[model samples]
Target: MSLLLETLTTGDRITFICTGLLGLGVLALLSRPKVVAAEDGVTVTNLTTTRRLDWAQIVRVNLRSGDAWVHLDLSDGTSLPAMGIQPGIARDRAIADARALRALVEAHGTGHSAT
Candidate 1:
């Protein structure tokens, strides 16, 4: 009877541990950042990083080969690449965005950093 009780308790412990692990995994997934682009700006959120940028701060947009790259032009002619970029297949929309980005960069004096 004692051995049976011990076996049951061990099984219970294992179940408890597994349940806790599963719950933690779900929590992690739920905490992942959400990235969104708005009419005025871009927002990026994640477990470890959160960034937001306004339209005026954008330097340039480049669609190279199959990848879309964003260049943030700075006063010193350096640029920073913002997150939330998708790789490959940037055809029409990417080109349009790139043109808009170029216009913005030209307005800002043409110094930018590339990612």
Candidate 2:
């Protein structure tokens, strides 16, 4: 490995470093945050935290215009951001996903207490 590193020209080394940095940037953006829906609940995993909420604890799912992603309104008077449904290049797809999530919340989150 040391021999290989020593054989590269300055330009080649710069190119290699730039490519590696660009790859890392793409990876970081792709790994930002996400949400997952299971049989009984949804999980929101962000860069720093992962939160799981049962269906009964969710009051509604909101994806208003101009918003970056879906938001979950909980019965506990707090809201959680669903980063999986982000808006940007795929706005229509994101809207569709938000609708599907709303349907899931409505189907399974009604008539139950947050206890």
Candidate 3:
């Protein structure tokens, strides 16, 4: 760390420090997407934004064979992409997560719930 700092000018050093801080600030946000289910609702943390949805608001959880991630069919007639249940590196886990979320939606949702 000292060797890297020693080679840079004062302005460059400041810039480097600022960049490092900025990079680390959003590191976790970029590294992992999450879907958390609680008694009240589900919280989905995507790449840059997070959304909270009540169980009744989610009509279905769709994760087709060729899909990259699960998608929620909402009561408001919009689809929300859930990147947390992606089938890229962990296909079995993703499928299991998708099934679990789907089961929750089916059990709790009342408005147009389906398989």
Candidate 4:
């Protein structure tokens, strides 16, 4: 009887350990950084807080191959990777969003080629 009890206790301990690890992994994913482009500028946020950037400071915008990126280039030659935009995963929306961003960049007079 004691041997059976020991086995049950061990199993419970293992289950509890696995559950804890899974919970931590979920938290990490939810806490990932996300970026958004608004009317005034762009905003970068994460589980902790948010950041904002004005449109005038933007240099260029890049559309990458993956399904989870929408980067914005700054005037200082720095690139800011954005989130909440996964066009590659959804072809229709991705192409539309890319076109809109390209138009906005060109309108702002950055003079960058869209190749």
Candidate 5:
């Protein structure tokens, strides 16, 4: 409002603008996550990073009932969080996506499920 703008100092207005921009950037980043399945591998784009993984590298795909999103178990003995398959509001879609990704990992890589 005009009153609020009039009361704020120039530095305060600049700081407020920067903070709003940063918040928008964070929200954009949160919505930027996705999973891409290619011929050779899968690409997981999380909040702050993107990882390209070979089919063989992914040992398992886990999306349990209580889980908020899919987690990929890699052959390197590490688990990577895949936010692309989150089951928050779209639970069924997320489940299907997890299953499809799992099938791709199995058919293209080692048909091995977590033991």
Candidate 6:
């Protein structure tokens, strides 16, 4: 390792480090969680788990102030984070998306609450 480090110029070392960091950023972005709402249900895909909940199973959809993302309250007494409606960068768009999701729940879900 010492010999390899010695062989690399300062520019080469910086380039290697930057490349590694870029790779890690890309991997993190790719692995970020996602949520999709369909006619039948909502699908949430996180790093280690993927869950699908029917319209009836979701009790509420909320995107409160300062929240990083939208959250879904489920009938099973649990809440799931929805990464698709992130709160930074395109905040207006995220809010719009969250509203649209809430509308979907209200229209399709039986007696579900949304906010």
Highest lDDT scorer: 5
Alpha-carbon lDDT of model 2: 0.81
**lDDT against the true structure, each candidate:** 0.54, 0.81, 0.84, 0.66, 0.90, 0.83
- Best to worst by lDDT, what's the order? 5, 3, 6, 2, 4, 1
True-structure RMSD, every candidate: 6.9, 5.8, 2.7, 4.8, 1.9, 5.0
lDDT for each residue of candidate 5 in 1-115, tens digit (9 for 90 to 100): 9998899999998999999999999999989889999999999999999999999999999988888789999999999989988899699899889889988999999836531
- Tens-place lDDT digits, model 3, residues 14-66: 88899999999789676768899988889998998899999999988888878
Q: Tens-digit lDDT track for model 1 on 25-109?
A: 9888656644455666655555566767565555555445645444445444555543334343345655565565555455543
Q: For model 3, what is the C-alpha lDDT against the true structure?
A: 0.84
Clashes of each: 7, 0, 0, 0, 0, 0
Writing each residue's lDDT as its tens digit, candidate 4 over 39-105 gives: 7666766555566777677676677565366666777788666554457567677666666666766
Clashing pairs in 1: 33-45, 33-46, 73-112, 78-112, 78-113, 79-112, 79-113
Q: Clashing pairs in model 4?
A: none
Model 4 residue 102 lDDT score = 62
Which pairs, if any, clash in model 5?
Answer: none
Give the best candidate by TM-score.
Answer: 5
TM-score against truth, every candidate: 0.38, 0.71, 0.78, 0.58, 0.90, 0.73
- lDDT head-to-head 1 vs 3, winner: 3
Residue 81 shift from truth in candidate 6, angstroms: 0.6
